[model samples]
Target: MTGTLITVAPTGAESSKAAVPALPVTIDELVATAKECEALGAAIVHVHIRDDAAEPTLDQGRLRETVAALRQSTDLIVQLSSGGAVTDPEADRLAVLDARPEMASCTMGTVNFGDGVFLNRWEFIVDLHTRMQDKGIVPEYEIFDLGQLTTLQRLLAQHGLPYGGHVHVDLVMGVPGGMPGTAAALVACHQAIRDLPAGSTFSATGIGRSTIPVILASLATGGHLRVGMEDTVTYAKGRPVESNMQLVARAVGFAQLAQRPPLTTAEARELLGMVAR
Candidate 1:
């Protein structure tokens, strides 16, 4: 198997500093986290920025500054979250692509996120995909349920290939209302879309308790991994994670033991079809 691509999601739109104190909220904290995670073997940093008050916002200025700061501070591939928060406006979410990060997320379909719905309508998905293509931003398709795979198939069939023609996906499992985070679920997701996009690849992030299981399963299945506070806040049962670097170091250890060493920033860029920086 090729080297495993490790992506560290330092912060997410859902959590707060009050809930997860280690969560990086400011641009400086995010840059520090990205640099530490990169040194610990993470090739990519999945980012979500907040306002001065640490509340989620899709403000173009903040997004641009966060992306630029990350780019200047670390060699890791910076992937901005277009799925800002459940409450963010569609126009604002779509406008995030204007920051022009190396990559951005494009959720395949709407799914119940906890008690709220993450509304990604067909037209919205197509529009986001088209815009990402137009801006030369690579998309990491976020799959929260099995049926979304079919939606992804429809997307490719209808919209032609995404930007670079290299399809990459992230199986965001274990959301309360989405697919379960289990080996079976991960395997089923892979099986469903494995044959659709030619040379397509995927990574898995199991939220909460599903983290370790999904990590092991993704490695065993020849897929990559997405880890850190975005999907998990605990280092173990009841153990709050101290830093994103801790999760990344643990993943690198696991990948090494499995004989799939972690990919460097350069290798990950090549693997994901991103131009060298």
Candidate 2:
């Protein structure tokens, strides 16, 4: 309810550099994008590392290096995506924690991701949550569907609270197999969030064309925003997104208009219960 916590996911595992040239694939590109987004009011950088060929990778060495470089370059909360690629093995995905990021994403449930299924078995979800708790890495739960909220409650009641003791989630809307990005769906999700622990916060990201609609609905509903080419390549009809900063700036403007503005890096850390480094 203070200011919006804007998180910029510069590159995801799905896009290819050959197609989305603006996507930041290399560590240098990721650093540059993180710096720019931080300056544009983004408080967190949700990262997904790529191999030399610009393809998604769960290589532990590269992941560690990327985490170190981002920490050196920017004050943004470095959050590595534990859901690497739908094809990523459970061992590799769990090993993402060895990178020791300030925070990491933990998808609550499995959902269809385009043509492939993103499998998050109950055991896998509990393992991811328990490991994050043991490692003291804060988790930004990724909810892809409505029922996932129930799964989150079950996880919390059974396992215990995540590291940092703050519960924050990212609603990934409009995925072909997930919930829609309409205001109605967002409102329903938001309503469901009330059933969570008090002070729990949520941010929403709408895939592709659902970007602006989700942004508008999130702001109107007092939620945070996540934007980047990871969720959208086309800025508008027939117009391609130029850069991640473009999306961040637009979200900042919306937050400002809503009078929520954007939270600073330190403020974000405190809000999310992240230990200052």
Candidate 3:
């Protein structure tokens, strides 16, 4: 098996300009940065797009353009996010993957986003899994907490869903209401994944300060690590990150020190079992 499969989430749906200066806002910028990350050592580029009106709309046409641009520009594995700034309507979330990127985000459970709710109703999740399968796009199951992994297993058992042999999971941590990304918490989440239905591949990512501890723990366990301005903005203490690629470069060194070699884009895709674009 290859080492850590670093998925560079250049821009999260809710990642703001205030948090990271070089956050990709335009399609051209996002595609350019994704290619840069691939060159720096990223296998998968997870994307979130905006509508024609500049709002975070799930316009399929815009998404197609983003995917096409990235494909034309780089050999990196492209992964679109089903997560939206507003995830109430599942159709809206699935619209981006209607263009059929190699992989799409499969957020597994509901979460409390500040004062509001980020609900992933049962019906939509099941239906979206089928949609992703119909388009031949593999899913990277996203878990905000341990319980959501259960949702993923249930959907897999019920529908033989997602239609892909390996389901890639992004174990998210330190999202306030979600699992705290401490070393022990990170280990606990990885343990929970071991009990998931057979044939599932998993990786861990931490938000804010928890990124350091969670990433270190993941490395110790032979699990892959995900880092970007989307997960964190600072490197250590109060220092700021120059770019998403900078964070990725730092992770590459960390992987080596942890006795694991960093994966190239091709190796990362193979390790994650994603379809190469």
Candidate 4:
């Protein structure tokens, strides 16, 4: 917690460009978003690519191109999403590593995602972890509930440490079926994280209305922050988010106010064990 590590998840698999026109669905848009967010304060970009139709897709080619373009454009650590639309097949999801990103998201377990179930069976989780370790790709474990942290511990105990030897997690709260996005819940999650490996770091994301509350709670507890249009569309009660840059600027402002200004990309790379010491 030396400095706040702000991550920008510009676009997620669940959001639609039609619904949120500003969602970065194309490679050009994503690269632009990455550059702007990196300049604003974000050290990492948690990415989920879409097809020509602007729909969620785990296509390997598109994934590779996206990774390449982001790297060429910005210093932000590109993290691909392995939990592609709940409907993505395991093979395709696993194949995301073929893109060879610096980091990728590995959801610890499955949960009821709104109307559909975001399935992450034990075997699938193990496969994703082992593959990332093999490829030297660091993983940011996505924890939707408190119990998933326990599962993360078990995974480490059984399969050994992930590649890069650092354990980082993201608390995705306030989803319809996951943990609530409240200061109390964030504190509980923060406490539960102590059971994880020593020095493990985490970032909290509050979907929809819980966004600001979760951000404040995370900063107070010395945790990190992740923000973007992917988690929220409305910036306020009646005001819609203009773009991802607006969100990144807001996060930067918050970190500055907390006296924990955002970390640089190089610092973030070291923090995540991405660079060789």
Candidate 5:
């Protein structure tokens, strides 16, 4: 198996400091988390910035500052989240790419997100894809369902190539309204993506109880991983995680046991075809 590229999603739009105390909401906390995760063998930090109130935001200044801090403090690849919060306006979502980070996320399609809807229309997806291409930002396509994989195929067919030309995707499973997080489901998703751009890679993230199963499946399937408080707050049943580094450490241990150690920052960059910063 290839060296696993572990991406640490330290904070997500859904969780808050009150719910997950160790969540890195502030820039300082985020930078500290990034450094520690990198030291624990995380090659990338998938960032979601929060405001003073600890609410998610796509504020250009905050994002720009957060990106700068991560760049200065660690060698980890900093990827900004364009899926800021479900309620975020489309304009603000598009503006996130303006922060000019090395990487950003582009959801393949809309899905029922719990009680609410996570909206992503074809026009919005195309616009984000084009803008990322213009800004030289590599996109990590976020897929919540099997059908979204087909949407991605259509995207590449119509848009030619995404920014950076290399394709990387994230299989976000076990959401309340999306695909079930199971070994069979993950393998099916992986098979579907095989028709994508040649050499396209993927990372699997199983939220809540599905976390461990997804990690094992990805490891066994020659795919990468996305782990942290963003997708899971618990280290085990009834056990809340203490830090993102803890989650990353466990992933590194698993990868190594499988003979696929975590990828270094430089190796991750090369694997993803990212431009040097």
Candidate 6:
């Protein structure tokens, strides 16, 4: 099996300091956590900025602060959330691509937020993807459900690179009203992503308790993974995880047991076709 790239999403919009107190939120905390995750075998750190009281926001100033702190300590690839809080509509969501940290996640299509619908029209999607391409930043495609898969296909077709050098894809599963967590669900997501062009790579991430289930299934099926308190607070069934690095270490151990070695930061960069700085 090809080595896996373990990306640790230290803090996300939905997960809380209360749910997982060790979750990284502030600039200092996030940088520290990203460094620790890197130490624990994660090649990439997926970040979502939160406010002083732990509320998620993609506010430009806060994102700048968080990323600056991250660079001071490590060169680990930082992927930001353009899908912040799902409730924050289209106008409120965007990647501050000005910093251009090698990679960022771009949601293919919007789905329902808890009480309302999340919105990302073709204009926003195309504009962001175009911006990432122009900036040479790899945009990790996020698909919350099957319909979003088609949306990604449409974008891929529109881009049509000379050698299919499209941005990477991340199959995000287990959101409410989105795809359920099942082995079959994992298979379906794999098939959808594999249907894309030859060069693009994909990763699997599941919300809440389904995180490890999907990770392992993805591993068994030859796919990369993302994990941490941001996705699931538990270390195992009924057990609480203490930190993001703990989850990363557990994933590394599981991958070893499955005979799937993890991709180093350099190897991960190669897999995603990123240029070295």
Best by lDDT: 2
Candidate 5 at residue 33, lDDT? 91
Query: Candidate 4: misplaced stretches above 4 Å?
Result: none
| Rank ordering of all candidates by lDDT, starting from the highest | 2, 4, 5, 1, 6, 3
Candidate 6, superposed: residue stretches over 4 Å from native: 161-166
Off by over 4 Å in 2: none
| Tens-digit per-residue lDDT, 81-181, candidate 5 | 99989999999999998889899999999999999899999999999999988898999999999999999999999987877678999999999999998
Model 1 TM-score on a 0 to 1 scale: 0.98
Off by over 4 Å in 5: none
Which candidate should be chosen as best, given TM-score against the real structure?
2
Worst 10 residues of 3 by lDDT: 49-58
Please, what is the TM-score per model?
0.98, 0.99, 0.92, 0.98, 0.98, 0.92
Tell me how far the alpha carbon of residue 57 in candidate 5 is from the true structure, in angstroms, after superposition.
Answer: 1.1
| Candidate 3 or 1, higher TM-score | 1
**Positional deviation of 47 in candidate 2, in angstroms?**
0.6
Q: Write the per-residue lDDT of candidate 1 for residues 15-89, one digit (tens) a residue.
A: 889888889999999999999989989998999888999998888999899888888888989899989899888
Greater TM-score among 3 and 4 belongs to 4
- Candidate 4 lDDT over residue span 1-277, tens digit each: 7699999998998878888888899999999989999999999999999999999999889999999999888888989999889899999999999999999999999899999999999999999999999999999999999999999999999999999898999999999999999999999989989999899999999999999999999999999999998899889999989899998899999999999999999999999998732
Cα lDDT listed for each candidate: 0.91, 0.94, 0.78, 0.93, 0.92, 0.78
User: Tens digits of per-residue lDDT for model 2 on 95-119?
Assistant: 9999999899999988999999999
Report residue 223 deviation for candidate 1 (angstroms). Answer: 0.4
Better of 2 and 4 by lDDT: 2
lDDT of 5 at 99: 89
Clash list (residue pairs), candidate 1: none
**After best superposition, candidate 2 residue 259: deviation in angstroms?**
0.3
